[model samples]
Target: MKKLLTFSKQAVLIAVPISLVISIYVNSLVTILFLLVFLPDLIKNFKKNNFSKNRKVFFVFSAFVLVYLIGIAIDILYGTANFRKSERLLPFILFPLFLLFSDALTVFEDKKTPLKIFGIFVLCFNLFLLVNLFTQTVVEYNDNSLSNKRWKKSNIKILENSKERYALFPVSEIHIADVASRPDLLMERSFKFSRDTLITRSVYVKSNDDVWLLLRQFDGNRHEGAWFHPKTARVGFVQKNITADIQKLENGWSRISVTNRVAKKANRERLQITFVDENKQYDVKGNVEYQLYVGGTQLEIGDSPSDYMPLQHRNFLEGFDRTTILNVVEGHPTYYSLFILISVLIIILFFRSGYVQFLGLVLNLVMLVLLGSKAAILTFFILLFLVLCFNFKNRDSRLKLLYVVIPLSIIAILSFSNTLNRFNQSLSSVTEKNDVVYLSTDKRIEMWKSVIDLPLLNLVLGNGNRHGYELLESSTALTLNSHNQYLEAVLCSGFIGLILLLFFVVGIFFVDFSARNNQLLILFVVLVGFNLFFENLLNRQWGIVFVAFFLSYIYKLGEVNE
Candidate 1:
């Protein structure tokens, strides 16, 4: 019986972490069976008649969970309870109930084992998402400038093959929204063409007034020199290249022949083609009777666009909104990414070899940037710097260059990817814009200010996050939670709840900082605690489960390694 009980505990220990991660991934309440992690101990807690000695453990260690319980009770009494908002406190209740009922949380305190299992699986899952991000965004044609470049092959080529052969700018970036936004929109693409290649495109032009479509040749890279050819030099690069009046273009998408007589020599030369659409403004909200269209460049060597290579309405070349990598793989990429990043960072700083640590650091940092959550990225850098400083404490003064070099290289690499650089861009813009990244720092600031400007009395117990949420929707660009978790805590439970949370966090750190595995615990707290300043992660399941599970697990092991 003793041996059987021991094996059951061991089995639950391993299975618990796996369950936590998979439960969140599958995102089904049914997967919450991971709660069995604390079941054995909870039974012990309930059977303790008076709960005598366990009471102190409950107050000292359970304050973190108590914070939420108090808030929920208050909200319930006030009749302002939001079920989703109220439920964020569930993890806190479970984790500490076990801790309170039992003398020690040792049964579940195999710290590295749970984290290692969770990290390995989460890492693989993230890598799959990363690979898919790269693959999914690259849709259209490939090398040799439209890969299978050839004559329209009107005589023999298969229909599917011919469309690819003659397509130019097949990845249509020319959106109706873009056209409505900018009337005189210019689109240009470079393609290598043999002198024998004839540049023929059929355009769909729609306008109430006469529209003059123009084409020009210039290097997209240098944005200067034209297609190199002996015959074209006679003009000294002057005319509008080629212009045509497509006033006869019917209702919307009618074919208009565009012939470029510029390229004379037959040798292969890279040439850029620019299509200039006639300027016309329309209602941006799609209320306009007529919308401008400038596409269908996917024509054969002949005059018309074929049915196979119709202009793509959506352009995959621009990438899926720059940072939907997690959106593609899962629903809660932002906070969830931070969770994974926190895991990888701990593994890098303390456990892995120097090279693997550095490699994982660089790669995951890039992934964080690509994931496009400003708070997560900021939390990453701050924690990384702290870890570096901690590790570098013993190094000689001569090694300080690493301190500067490491961070700068990361920033430099991340800077190159514009999609996720909202944090970087907000530094310069006087008026913040959400061009690529979803949220801007200024927008977050604006959201924070809404909470600050509230009456002092109302803020004391906050009208609840539902009220705060209404404030976000009314005051800002979008409806979002309090971007600051501290604020979120206060909003949900009032300052008392916030105070309880902070005190518990500080208390846990003091207790755990003495463990031989304290390096891991310290870094983990730093990651999650710091991120709370920027995001309301506790409201979400990924954050709720991960933080509660690991913190309790570590709490059980705290100082025991000593």
Candidate 2:
């Protein structure tokens, strides 16, 4: 019977790490599997003999579960928490319960073994995500290249036709031809002398095709523009150098020079020119139009430089694989990158190879930078600096210099690039531009302010679990949750609940610190605490899973070491 129980316990413990790794890449089905795997452990805990030996640790872990239960009670009493919101908070209850009861921690003689296993899974997943990103970037680049080639071909056709029509017209005498012979050639003119002048004319092309064209006049001003069909508006083109020299040849043809400015905003494939000859005005029109024809789809030339750069650089090293990874993972890269970094750090600390630790540290920094979350990157650097400072005494000179050099090099590169500028712009956009509704930081600030100004009752007991969204929507007409977990806690369960949650987290830290001076736990708390300031960590399944699993694992490791 004891053998069977031990076998079952070992099986479930091994499954947990496997499920966690699968859950990170796969869908919620894997997450369900993760939960189900803990069931046997929960059942084992129910058997009287399976209770954890560390009663204090169990109670402290259980406190987090109690805090959420109280919030649920408050929500039920106030009728504010619904099934949907209650589902999100289920992890708060479930994870703590799982940690408190599971025999997995006791199964590992050296708890760092399981941690190392989990870290290996995380690193492997990170590599998988990186591969996915590179593949997507290559595919996207090919698509863009095809699109650009089509656009260029269509543009060249229009320029060629315009040049051909202009060459046919005489410099001494210009005559307006009938539209029946060549309806596409709208205007053509030859000049006796080159003088800067602008010629403006509106020409209408009748086609449902989305066409892009290059309009070049006889002088030398050309404009690239696009034309959308089904609109009866006249598209205009300008030639900006109709000279002022008049030459009367032996024939009854005279070349007159006139300068005019072309309208920059016009989009037309052809131009209609009206030139004044003495007292007579000659009207000439060209019907040369270029149609976009690429893979049976029409192309346009309005893609802005700002839009193109990101698309081009996304496949490159600087803006690497975030979108691709996000598409697969369905969560922000910031969170996943943090997960990877934490995993790498765990390996570095516990794996016990100086060279390996240094390599992992460098990789962590690179991954964080590539992830491109300003807060995550900043938090990582700060934590790294602290780690260096705290471990300064124990480290040899080489390791110390390596730590300093790696981070400094990454920081210097980031500073020299537009990544830092964009991060600053994002910050400035939030604080300086209050009118921008799309800025997430601005919205978070507004939500925080609104929550702070809630009625005294709500302030004391919180509005209720998941009530923050409705409350924010009501107050600000914006449907958003408290992005900050600290604010979310206070908003959901009030100051009392917030205090309980904090106590649970602080309790874990102090308990672990007292049992064993595990520096990793301190770093874990720091990472999690910093993340809470920007994200509602507990509200997210990934966040909850990450925090709960690591905290429990670290605490268990501390218990074993003690």
Candidate 3:
């Protein structure tokens, strides 16, 4: 009988580690095990017990969950029973109850064993996500390539240039917003040139039939540009000193460039792309499709110094697979981004960075940017700056140089990517519905207004999760959720429950308030709190597991040390 109990204990503990990644059944099963394993013991402990530091933390953790439990009870008393909504939240109450039982029964010499096992599982899980992303990226890349899509899946923009109208342009990247600027731009299918510099127009083309292309600029009756046969490499210019070059790209696509050498004479501003052999060799409907590029000594664009150190042709590391191939496994890019942020936090707090940890940090940062949750990205950098500065005085000169250089260097490169535009959009204020590009930060401000507008009764004691969500849905018709965990917590649990949740988290600081522990504790608390402001993490299974497991486990790690 003792051996059977021990075996069951081992299986239950194993489930806890994987609870965060897998099904809601495993997570909720923690509660069933609690019922089977600790119901009688819990009743006894309730009858007579002392509040140890660990137990106190457990009470706070359980209270946060019980707010929902009690809310569900309030719900059932008025209507038919439905633990259905709150059942998934069982891990919070039950995991702590299980912890309480393990301590009471003296299950193991090291109570931290399960948490230690859970930590190892977290590392494996994160690594798996990275590897899974690699596989997904390859599959997506092949899909993107083979589809031969003329334009990207983002923003639904169509091809505009008339120069090459019959051929299909290469498949556009739909992986991330890496190509956000190129296709989304209100840019005309033409290039401009200055009076004193050469102007070059390059087009990447795939042809459906034979065609002659003409580039003409009609600036107040002065027509100055060139015409060329894409099939025969034949060229004619209305002006002197014009040049053209063609290069072959992969998969039947070719790059053709037309350059005006005497731009001062041409003063070319507006470019008109028309096929010369529209009716002769090809139909007037157009004969080629292409992605166009313009560069030279022109003011609108500029050339590279050398072929090797060429102009910034794409977003930061655009040719790489990491940016293009990944779509997150978690619910949203925001959730996955927050996961990476926490992963970086874990690495910094627990692991020593030689090269491996450094690489892990870099990988997380890259994933963070690609995921492109503005809040997560901003939160990550803030965490880095604060955590590094928290121990700035203790670091050696060498490490100090690295500390200062690292973020600056990252920002320098990242600035060139679409991340900067994302940041700018995040910063911009939205005064109208049309301006809400991403439901960015300002949209969050609009969402938060609904919180203030919540009914007084709902504000005091929330109308239960299900009804409260309906009310919030009505209140925030523009969005899905309130987008703030605290606000949503208030909506579900009421104002009093919000206070309980706050105490539940803030108590971690006072649980082991000392010099040795304060720094890491500060990082954990602030990071979680900051994220909760922007995301309704407490509402989701993945977010619930993250908050319940890590917050409890790390808090216990601190308490045990004391």
Could you tally the backbone clashes for each prediction? 1, 19, 4
Q: What is the lDDT of every predicted structure here?
A: 0.50, 0.52, 0.53
Tens digits of per-residue lDDT, candidate 3, 1-562, equal 9878766666665565465445555656663664576556567766665646557667767667766765565556546346665655666776666555344324546655554454445455556666766564344322312132211232322333334322343332111112222122111211223454544554444443355555544322244556555554445443555555666555445555555543322212343444434322211333323333221111124453223221112332332322232333324566556556666665565554445456556666665665566777777778878777776776533334336446754685466444554565455444344333233565577677777788788788766766666665676566477788788667767887788778766865555455236555567677778888888777777777667766665565555556
- With candidate 1 superimposed using the best TM-score fit, by how many Å does residue 345's alpha carbon deviate from the native? 3.7
Across 244-347, the per-residue lDDT of candidate 2 in tens digits comes to 22233322222222223433211122232222111121221334332321111111122121211111222244323233455554567767766765775676
Cα TM-score per model:
0.61, 0.64, 0.57
lDDT of 1: 0.50
Q: Candidate 2: which stretches are off by over 4 Å?
A: 1-55, 62-71, 88-90, 93-102, 106-109, 145-321, 396-402, 409-418, 430-433, 510-516
Pairs that collide in candidate 3 are 164-288, 165-288, 166-288, 167-288
Q: TM-score of the candidate numbered 1?
A: 0.61
Q: State how far residue 22 of model 2 sits from its true place (Å).
A: 4.5
On lDDT, the candidate that comes out on top is 3
Cα lDDT tens digits for candidate 1, 454-540:
777767875554555665567565666767877766766678878877865556544433433566667777777877887766767
Q: Between 1 and 2, whose TM-score is larger?
A: 2
Q: How much is the lDDT of residue 189 in candidate 1? A: 31
Residue-level error in angstroms, candidate 3, position 499: 1.3
Which residue runs does candidate 1 get wrong by more than 4 Å?
1-31, 45-80, 99-111, 139-322, 349-352, 392-415, 429-439, 468-478, 510-517
